[model samples]
Target: MNAFPPAQALSGRRPAVAVWPWPIALGLLTVFGLLSALLGQHGIWLALSWAALSLPLIVTVICLVRAWSRPSDKGGRS
Candidate 1:
């Protein structure tokens, strides 16, 4: 008999094909934000800096909300 339940059985599945595009994009935004801050302190540069910094913050809040709203596994934890 199998030691694990069918749902818990291990398999040699293929790895995920997903890429880190969002992280790379966020990093690029951070660099641009820094450059904008460095080059000047007014008008469009300020707007670009705020937007670049805010994008990552918005992403983080969205991820946190999704994670928090996801249902927890009843059988996995106390």
Candidate 2:
């Protein structure tokens, strides 16, 4: 077995913020987008809906990239 752990395991690097922010932001965006959509179908409402719908996708991509970049211990411990 390997005696040493990955650099991140030794260094104890962590995300600066908690996981809640993304979901909360996403929820707010969705609500706002829905409200905008309900009120109108053109102008700012359409723009808002598009931006809001894209947020979760953006967050997912960012998280996936981060996970892929981090080194794993190969044993699935991290």
Q: What is the alpha-carbon lDDT of model 1 when measured against the actual structure?
A: 0.70
* TM-score (all chains, Cα) for each model: 0.67, 0.60
Clashes of each: 0, 0
Q: What are the runs in model 1 whose C-alpha is more than 4 Å off?
A: 1-15, 72-78
Global lDDT for candidate 2?
A: 0.69
Candidate 2, pairs of clashing residues: none
* Model 2 Cα shift for residue 10 (angstroms): 4.7
Alpha-carbon RMSD, each predicted model? 8.0, 6.8
lDDT per residue for candidate 2 within 1-78, as digits (tens), equals: 123345644566533446676679889988887788788789988898888878878888987776677665353324
Q: Rate the local accuracy (lDDT) of all candidates.
A: 0.70, 0.69
lDDT of 1 at 53: 85
lDDT of 1 at 47: 94
Number of the top TM-score candidate = 1
